[model samples]
Target: MKRRKAIRNIVLFSLGTGIIYSCKDKYEAIKQLHLKHLIIDTKQLDILDDLSRLIVPLQNIPELADHTALPFIMNMVEHVFEEKDRQAFMKGYQSWDQEILSIKGRAFSAMKIEEKQQLLSEVNEESLKASQELYTVFNTVKEKSIQYLTTSEYYQRKVNYYQMAPGKFKGDVLLVDLKNKNDE
Candidate 1:
């Protein structure tokens, strides 16, 4: 019995070390898995990169440019969206680029960082006046925000900043729906 327990402990320690090394830096692992796919048309992809980074500035964590989510997003959009919608996306992209270029005299990605932020602000204002049927600029911005926060290294670090929550729980109680709060 003593010999069996010693063997079991040795095996468990080996497995733990393997798991720890394997789990190291998920961001770096994902980046390696997705790097080759990142090489698409620079012109089309740059808009996404520039816009997403503007929405989630790089101060708190890694820059959006570091994670390559913008290229991944562009690939997904070009391949996955319906034909008509893809066409609209392309058109919307061109129109937005033109608008920003007129304001800053350069492509959105090439503009100074401050100018990019200012352009996004103006774009948001214009989106507010959009008619019901039109897809507002804010919708594009929102999608870009979703794309960045879900994939960027900054977001990943933020999410993993804390250790995992404890697993064991003592008890549970039924919860009440709060929808009737308005009636009160």
Candidate 2:
């Protein structure tokens, strides 16, 4: 009986692990397909990389590039943006790409980190010149990119940091304190 139970537990655990890995691989494949279809412009891709790194700055956590934030951002840009916003994004993307080409005749991704940072700084300055609503579009994209990359369960497991004391919620301390204070 003990041997049978142990065998059943092992089978269940193996099946669960297999399903989880399969789902992860499928999600990755879908993400890759989405990125491939979008063919995101070089400038937008560069901006996305910068934004992702900014939000999830390298520390104990891995860099955003190690995740798929850039492709995720591109997918969002392709589907979720309104037509006008999309056009605006394309314009900004092209202009940034052209600037890089004129400076180094290479894509922004190929540039050195310092050069990329400088270019992004310039792009940010240009974005600021736009109207508030227009500027907000880019900001929205940046925020969503970070949120999806960092918190999505498919990419990273969500951790609950809250530690609750046992029987703490049912304790009468709060009521007693309130009653005493009222009497006083």
Compute each candidate's TM-score over C-alphas: 0.47, 0.45
lDDT of 1 by residue, 1-184 (tens): 9999997897686445321123335333333333321222335445655665666544345454454444345545556666665556556655666655664578666777787677667656664233321243335545755775666555554543322574754365333432242223
lDDT of each: 0.51, 0.53
Residues 1-184, model 2: lDDT tens digits: 9999997897686545321123334245334544322334333554555655654543235533445455555556668877666666655554554545655677666677787666556546773243444344356556676676556553453242223453445345687785675456
Question: Where is the poorest 10-residue window by lDDT in model 1?
Answer: 18-27
lDDT of 2 at 31: 41
Give the poorly placed runs of model 2, Cα more than 4 Å off. Answer: 1-31, 34-51, 54-60, 63-66, 100-111, 121-141, 154-184
Report RMSD (Å) for each prediction in the order shown.
16.8, 15.3
lDDT score of residue 64 within candidate 1: 45
Q: Which ranges in model 1 have alpha carbons more than 4 Å from their true place?
A: 1-41, 58-60, 63-66, 101-110, 127-138, 151-184
TM-score of 1: 0.47
